[model samples]
Target chain A: GAGVSQSPRYKVAKRGQDVALRCDPISGHVSLFWYQQALGQGPEFLTYFQNEAQLDKSGLPSDRFFAERPEGSVSTLKIQRTQQEDSAVYLCASSLTGGLGNTIYFGEGSWLTVV
Target chain B: AQSVTQLDSHVSVSEGTPVLLRCNYSSSYSPSLFWYVQHPNKGLQLLLKYTSAATLVKGINGFEAEFKKSETSFHLTKPSAHMSDAAEYFCVVSEDTGGFKTIFGAGTRLFVKA
Candidate 1:
């Protein structure tokens, strides 16, 4: 079965540019999450959505970071006016249920470089 | 707030030697603990999880972790190391504080020597 899918495994953008990263969660998954990981560090939470409703966006670093899951299955993280400090890997994860009883799976991640 | 701490930033072991990666968590509620492994160029894979059911949890690829509430630890261990086990390991924790939120610890990079 397909776990989770992310597009454009690598991306390089000029500073102040805008970029959008896409994620395709597994079929029937009710929960989706996004995280940012810098080199040599663990993943940091970005946002989460349960079905079409986004319940958490507190982890988003700044207003420049925006995410949307209009259809509930596919989600997008958009960054406006990117900065060099935003260089990191964006990871997408999903689970059958967001409860503590279910396990979450992750995608290969889209590595972004801001120059 | 919930958080996890991976004790070692890195650990090296020879092939066939015992492997251990330690993690400690802080949560206000009964926490769900998980261990995930990420190989180079690959996505994060679930190794095991403990959801307050059992103290000892076993995962894929011959990995296991013990959830000790007394010491607030969920340490992953393997009886023997394989060269292919070299990768980064992350200890994750989820807590339901009004809403469920998961947090990841600083990863532990395992170097398996042949």
Candidate 2:
């Protein structure tokens, strides 16, 4: 693909429902990141992956949010028991290098609405 | 610890006039700074980055930022504003502190008036 591709551009979930968002990063990109962006706010870091290794998950808001990149190519972010506060855009980004100061390419993001 | 602060929540500029967006950062080590623009309903696009290489960095769309270590600021500037430049701008700081994490500011909304 030309850039990072995210699935389910928009999703509306009921309270207590579980929702999964998928992200396909650029070809052979070594680093993948997940972020949450609320309305009128900048994107906040959620998790990061270096290949198949889950090196960092410090930014995940709570235990209900889980992200995995098992094969190191595609990643999924699953949220359990969605709350109204969870309604926001989830963005996926990828970078060629796994270090500070590296440029990251972002996807269009998946807009999630919890009713 | 490293963080970024965007001074203004909103800035309005007339087309063809100069644009200035203020940003300040705090870092314990040499930091890498970036400016990203996000249009309505669109993904963020990198405008420019300032590493340790050069103090002045030029980015896409006639946008540029200067790194001032003494002031702890990396303010974005453009000679002339355009209507198409209306968007949200974010200031980001990255440092290899606890881990490789990128911190984003609250973001400033730029409104260009024709």
* Candidate that scores best on lDDT: 2
lDDT of 1 by residue, B20-73 (tens): 999999988999999999999899999999988879988899999999999999
Residue-wise C-alpha lDDT for candidate 2, range A7-112, written one tens digit per residue: 8999999999999999999999999999999998999999999998888899999999999999999999999999999999999999998877889999999999
**TM-score of predicted structure 2, chain A:** 0.98
Looking at candidate 1, what is the lDDT of residue A93?
94
Tens-digit per-residue lDDT, B1-114, candidate 2: 888999999999999999999999999899999999999988999999988998999999999999999999999999999999999999999887656788899999999988
Q: All candidates: CA RMSD in angstroms?
A: 0.9, 0.8
Candidate 1 Cα errors over 4 Å, as ranges: none
Q: Interface RMSD computed for candidate 2 is what? A: 0.9
Alpha-carbon error at B84 in model 2, in Å? 0.4
Per-prediction DockQ comes to 0.81, 0.80
lDDT of each: 0.93, 0.95
Docking class of 2: high
Model 1 per-residue lDDT at B68: 92
Prediction 1 TM-score vs. true: 0.98
